[model samples]
Target: MNNNNFLKPLLFVGPHIILFIVFILIPSVYGIYASFTNWNLIGDPVWVGLDNYKTILTDTDSTFYSQFFNGLKNTLLFVVFSVPLLIIIPLLIAVALEHKDLKFTSLFQTLLYIPGLISISAAALVWSLIFNKQLGVANNLFGSEAVWQTTQPYAWIIILIITIWAGIGGNMIIYRAGINGVSKDLYESAEIDGAGPVRKFFSITLPSIRFPLIYTMVMTTAGAFNVFAQPLMMTDGGPRQSTTVLMMYIRDLAFSHGESIAGLASAMAVLLGLVILVISAFQYYVMNRNAA
Candidate 1:
């Protein structure tokens, strides 16, 4: 390759590089620096060094601890319920579509993917109406009067339903791509060996798509941690703050509260980042160990 080939690629990518540096890297570094100080919007940051962290962990009256714990709990619960369904349901649909005998596979794939393309805010708004006690079709169909958000477990159920509805389609497409990439020769070989569809899936199809499965799992975990828009739009952190997530809490701290502890919000963001990093690392280790 000539020297100009390298220069041309750099020219194409240079704008993105500059934008990333300006928008992401600079802000991230500044946020980290701000985390160790006491700064609101107007005043000069006073170096408080660990005081914000101390307040988050120890201040009972502040409700910071409660919010953090509640958010953590809800996020974990959402992950636990949604992740498996996200994987399994999509995988099953992909497998069904992979069959040559299936009719209108292209049409089915398009219909399934339509939901993923819809704006999350729009989807959440529609579901919010669906879960509304007085006007919702769900209440009307069931002849029930329970307030979905005010009720304990039902509130969570509503959140889960909306989450699954919006999320499953993207994963399904990924899985379908993975399934399509598997060579027909492998299936023929399995057939010659008297292996059934179930056997072929477990032994051949699943192993062929291990990388996609791992990628999806990691993305899902990170997405769960950063879940803000759905709960924020659908529940507003809730009738009892049942749907409040960590990101929403951080936003509330940084902007909504007049005290506006930019430092505390930064700390929370950093801590959440650390949690995601640790979980991802652990997952990678376990996967590699199992492969080995």
Candidate 2:
């Protein structure tokens, strides 16, 4: 009986464990190894020790150096702009939908969540037309003559708009679930104590959903760092590559025309991963300490 109980649980989780090890763990280990070597994805990887990292980090006159810094700067800008909106808008929507007087909550949730299910490529195409300079609805409606794709801040604005639109649903669902799990008795007690909506939210709801807040914030920041599609399709990292993100640079280096700079790409990827790890760890520490 004891063996059967153990076997049954393993049966349920074993496949996932195998898949994670095979796909995620093995690839991650190999990628880290590859970052130390020169690889073109076809020939045998030539061990170059820290050459790739040194060039990317210290070779200020190199094109790789310029690309790395610019890409990282743009990526950080995206995270700064998008992460807060992604968290706050979803949380606000989730809170609004939690109102007792709200009708058709399920319908609203479905409508919001459906966008997230759509592919980023398709969403970008749709948004591109909406922001098209000659015949776009944006110009037609607003009576402005700005070319959204080629303009400075307008280029960034559309990327953020699409990102937030597709992203809002998933985090909102998480917040809604977190909000739903809070005990109703707590709200009633707050009401009895003459707590207003904002007060109750800060005191009761926020504290109750602390884990979800931490989760969404961390995940959203990580996702924002890896952003590639919106800028790729919407503006093609245009207006002098002002919107080019780190992932775009990484992809270009790894698989661009002619020789692939796999080693450099892997180094960039590893660096980006370290940045994410440090930030996520800091966020976890701060949020966990506050919760405690």
Candidate 3:
């Protein structure tokens, strides 16, 4: 019976195992292998051993490496600006909405979450129109002739604005869900102790959602690293490549500029993956240690 019980679980899990092996595991191993070869998608893959990696890491004049570094720098900048809005602003909104005396709570929740439902490509295109140099609504509204996408600081600023606008809603919903999961009795007890909203939030609300906070931080970090579509569509990594993000760099290396360096791109991918993994692991370790 015990053996049959185990077999039953395996039977249910067998399809998932097969799918994972066929899709994720196989592709990952193949990608690593392909990274070491000089495959241009048209000719046979020449086994170059570590040459591709060496070129990517050491070739200072190579556009691939230069673009990769530029993208990495921009991605770091995006994370620095985006993380606080993703975490703190949403938390504040969720806490405010959780108030029993708050008016139109459901309406406010729905309004906040609506932006998250918009398609990223469509949103990027729309923002591009708004940030257009000559005909943009923003230029008209501000009575300034500043070309948002053509100006260095304004290009990055536009990217940041769109990112925050599209992202905050989904994060707010997650935070609201976390806040909702907190036991009402805790709030009631706090109220009985004459704790005001600020005191209750600091002592009870924030502490209870520690798991969600960690989750939000990790996800926002990863998302910030992977920001590609907005910059790709809106800025084309322009304004002197100020908006060039890491994933876009990888994409350009792999397919764009009529010079497909698949192997070098794959090397970049592996390095990026390693960087993300290390950072995420460090974050987890720090958060866990603090909790302990």
Ranking by lDDT: 2, 1, 3
TM per prediction: 0.91, 0.94, 0.91
Output the lDDT of residue 176, model 2. Answer: 95
RMSD of each: 2.5, 2.2, 2.3
lDDT (10s digit) by residue, model 2, range 31-146: 99999999998898899999999999999999999999999999999999999999999999999999988999999999999999999999999999999988889999989899
Q: Which candidate is the best by lDDT?
A: 2
Candidate 2 positional error at 6, Å: 9.6
The window of 10 residues in a row where model 3 has the poorest summed lDDT is 38-47
lDDT of each: 0.84, 0.95, 0.83
Q: How many residue pairs clash (N, CA or C atoms closer than 3 angstroms) in each of the candidate models, in the order given?
A: 0, 0, 0
- Model 3, 15-103: lDDT tens digits are 89999999999989877887899877667777899987777778898776687788778888888888887788888888889878789
The true-versus-predicted C-alpha distance at residue 155 of model 3, in Å, is: 0.7
Model 1 ranges off by over 4 Å:
1-13
Task: lDDT for model 1, please.
Answer: 0.84
| lDDT of each residue in 1-292, candidate 1, tens digit only | 8899889999999989999999999998988888898878578888889887777777777777777778778777777887888788889999999987889999998888887888989998888888788899889998878788777777778777887777888889899999999999999989999999999999999889988888888888778778887777776778688778889888888898478877878878887888889998887788766655
